[model samples]
Target: MATLLELREEPHWSYSALNTYLNMCSLKFAFQYVYKAESERTAASLPFGRAFHIAATHHAQSVMQGKRMTLPELHDVFAQWFKLECAACTNLTFKNGESINSLTEQARFMLDALLARWIDWNNIVSVAHAFKVQVPGLGKPLVGEYDMVIKDGETTSIVDWKTSAARWSEGKAGRDFQATAFSFAYLLEEDHGMIPLFRFDVVTKTKNPSLENHYTQRTKDDLYRFQLLALAVERAVKQEVFLPAETSFCCGDCQFASACKEWHRSSAAKHICMAA
Candidate 1:
């Protein structure tokens, strides 16, 4: 099957939706609080009212759906959607078994595509799903969410998912630092005990196999590149180096787009411009 980038050439969505997506990425990346460890990222402690904002968004999505579905429903039908079964859903359906048709069935499901990238059904002896590890000497640090913490007997790897119309193969620089941060959290906390292996997966959500859709797995060296890049960032953060990259991609979706674009890389990319 052809890759998604070569398939439709473009996936259609409202300008506002795309801009909102970009803005969410920017907000998390720019703010120090959201980047904090898992223990620090609760609904109550978020700075600049982001916690409230996130809660509200989920509430809004739930409101539209009429009710929440089970993990399987969320995983299969709408794991990647803004609604229960919208055509615009882009992420993976993780929960196994049959999907329930009803809208509101109580079950836990992580809604974020980037976070869901870590889930694996073929979990080996080394991989774990949603495992929590605490470091002994890391000053009570908050370990972030490791979507899939693989513990194949001896090797423990951190996995993450990326679900976008465009895959990471389209660009390597787009590797998320927040994802890397989650890996580090596990390393500092989880590795202190037994597992030492660490790997991140960027599974591009193409059409399903039976659906005649094909996707390319981004692994090995690709995942390592992000690991090293994020390492530098972690070091910089330790040194209080908070220099913003000032790129259009970072600021374009931001409320501060206009102010930041005065120095951004691409002037034209600063607005919520639709692509042809």
Candidate 2:
């Protein structure tokens, strides 16, 4: 078995899934799952979710171009990630509860719940089939891995996981950008009444949906925010303007703390120093 370090170093990207995406990108940029391409186009314009990762890479590149992210800068860079991911960054800035640690914890908790929920997805989604796809045209494959690639009989999709709380929203039922990015990434196209739809199976774990509560799922407008958020992040990454954005909710319950020691300045001290 590959070590966690190895897995992180080389994620299980599905070439079958990614090949299909590059094919589309090279062949006039069409998607089977995108009803709204504008937002996704915008997100694709930059690297939103991985802002901190990019920033770290850039800095690392300044000294050591191909080096990996150090153990210390992970969380802050993760928090720095939200700087370009407009959705929750703005919300956290507005709500004043956006602690990097808090949001990170909530995201972690949500993913735990999502994994739990996914264990039962075959049940929640009555009938579905998963097919390994090979997108045409790209020089290289695109997907890191398909978490739960499936065709719901009713629609074609590549289900992905988002950890931020602001993404728990719905609107046009089956079309949201976070979901659309994957659709575009996978080159899904419109079929039947369903356009290329990206579903947000948000996992907020709690009997009652409260601020501090665990996880929840949705197909809502907040998902639209997800689209916007994704666009913003991608855009910012291209610009290389990943200045750290300090927000109230941006740094709550951050798990990268243990791994990201350089940012901590000392081994024993825990918690991020508020953005100065």
Per-residue lDDT, model 2, residue 199, is: 47
Q: Which window of ten consecutive residues has the lowest lDDT sum in model 2?
A: 26-35
Candidate 2 lDDT (Cα, whole model)? 0.34
Query: How high is each candidate's TM-score?
Result: 0.37, 0.31
Q: Candidate 1 versus the native: TM-score?
A: 0.37
Lowest-sum lDDT 10-residue window in model 1: 40-49
Residue-level lDDT tens digits of model 1 in 1-276? 333224224332221222223434433343423233222212111111222123323433443355543335434433333232323222223233323222112112223332233233344332123333332322222223343344555555554433333344443423544433444444445335322344434332233211111222334454455445444444433443333445545343333333333423533233223221
Off by over 4 Å in 1: 1-142, 170-180, 190-244, 258-276
